[model samples]
Target: MLKGHDFLITVKAPGKLYIAGEYAVVETGFPAILVALNQFVTVTVKESGDYGSIYSQQYRENSLLWKREGNHMVFDNRDNPFHYILSAIKLTETYAQEIGKKMKCYHLRIDSDLDSPDGKKYGLGSSAAVTVATVKALCHFYNLPMTKSRLFKLAAIAHLDIQGNGSLGDIAASVYGGWIAYNSFDRNWLKKARHRYSLTALIDRKWPQLNVELLTPPKELSLLIGWTGSPASTSHLVDAVGLKKAEQVKNYQKFLHDSRACLKRMIKGFQTKSLATIKEEIRRNRKLLQSLGVLSDVQIETPLLHALCETAEKFGGASKTSGAGGGDCGIVLINDSSNTQALLANWKEVGIEPLDLHVHRVND
Candidate 1:
């Protein structure tokens, strides 16, 4: 018989922002810079009466019941808002079973600050954060000694299972925290491996092919995040961009070459504390994105996004739409924070909400 009440465990993971090398990160498998924002998704697990239940404060779901079927965990409700959570629980439970451990029944409460006060997701990688947090909480609850790398791989697998695409850069930032320079692992290789081995089997072994490096931003640099009040579907945008690339293969390849070079310079700028180099790379990046938008006839950047960048530029800052960025959050990198108020005021006047976010770590 399992104990009805035992212990409570909570885990929090930070959201992420892709600072540079967005579209190309998926295609070229090059290094993409990502920062873990202070915004976090938190999961708390505690003992329950009978079966387990979940309450998602972010999604406003009162109570959701989940059960274990053989070696797998399954959500009792379909079309629920806890896709990531459900997937995470299933994976964690499976891992525990494979390692000859049993998990007790418990209630989990999930919440997030990645949304606005009114509950609008601000394009922060909330899904990835939630996945990481859930896995961490599960491991903690079951007394599993999962290393950070193993946790990352589990979270990445859950994330990939849902979205079916992505470079897992967001997952890396959430798992490792702080800032990271991530080179995309070969999706083809991962696909083949997944078919050949179980997730637990893969976690037991190390893959020399995975590449993730930490990068420190310049001390003089200030990063400001601004929400556009409009949401963009990253998958849709990525798919559209992919279609455009297929249509204009040669041009897209040339653009990728330039973007790759620009990202390298941007990385170097961070290391050397060269603000001018960073700004130039950012400018080239936006120009290339704009060129892609024009060629594909897609909405890469909105009018307000451009206006925010221009306003920031007036204050000796460089801004660009971060991530898939038709309308979501834009990143503003400032060398001089002397006039941050002015830049923020200009952005506010144009209906952009400047989010107060910064680099964050899991344990800090």
Candidate 2:
């Protein structure tokens, strides 16, 4: 049930995904197209008490409510998701001043349900969805008079502020939902310094309506979704890439460039929308990721993942890392669910487990 103050917006933030082409976007300065996943971070806002307060469920798990005064407005950190929501709100408040929508204090209860709670691979970017949703709600709450595109740009900038060096791909995909050619680096945006180097010369561009499917593994899908059990820290990993960037600029950028090309090839191949072509492209992209540091030999393609692919050969599709590959839950795309019973039992025979997921795209 979605409640509102006559203009309340009910929005579901989609999950972030890197289907292909990473590390390359960092320096070689290529474009990467990301898509929004089906699972989401849902938010619902209703009129709170008198002061217009925000009630966050996760924050209540820690403590009830947190209130503080800022340079311009009195803000409250009601919960984890709303905390980021407040950051976006504050920024919007400033932007509103630019036009003429003066905003005062208001109490709003923010409801959030983002945990994989039982600890499944719900993936990151779920909170990012909430951040996006919260920002949209705030825009409506105050009649901020901002367009969706304006709100998206503000949300990306705000997400970076919250994550402390966010790549901006996740937020972009979450907001846009489909496919886009996104590159985080631009000498134009990177620095005010004018460079003779033009982004046009080195880049090849195209925008295609992507066809993504939620692959349902067979009943006995020989799938082993091993949790490296250790979540990699995004900041440290980005720092490591940065440190290496200065030393191995040419080699690293080349890998990313090649990877970006591989992604383009895959997206182009999808024009025919053939399963065989998609699998081959995925294999090529896996090799490219392995060549780059994003997907390592051992970590990205674990013995379990490899063996699972081999076993899934009977069912026959492909497998690869769905995101930054330092031991996150990777995906195995199956051909058809025909032999589901036998295939899934085989997964149990080995040590791998399956996840309850579908590779779905967003509705227009």
TM-score: which candidate is best?
1
Mind giving the per-residue lDDT tens digits that candidate 2 earns over 4-100?
A: 6544455566766665665555442565656565666655555444466666654455433333556555333322355577777766665666556
Q: Which pairs of residues collide in candidate 1?
A: none
Residue 312 alpha-carbon offset, candidate 1, angstroms: 1.0
As a whole number from 0 to 100, the lDDT of residue 213 in candidate 2 is 30
Cα deviation in Å at residue 146, candidate 1?
A: 1.6
**In model 1, which regions exceed 4 Å deviation?**
1-6, 61-81, 204-209
How well is each residue in 254-316 modelled by candidate 1, as lDDT tens digits?
878988888898989888878888888888888988888887778888998888788888888
lDDT for residue 123 in candidate 1, whole number 0-100: 83
Error of 1 at 78 (Å): 14
Q: Which stretches of candidate 2 lie over 4 Å from their true place?
A: 1-9, 27-29, 47-52, 59-83, 108-114, 119-121, 145-148, 179-181, 185-230, 294-314, 337-353, 359-364
In model 1, how large is the Cα lDDT of residue 341?
91
What are the models' TM-scores?
0.90, 0.72
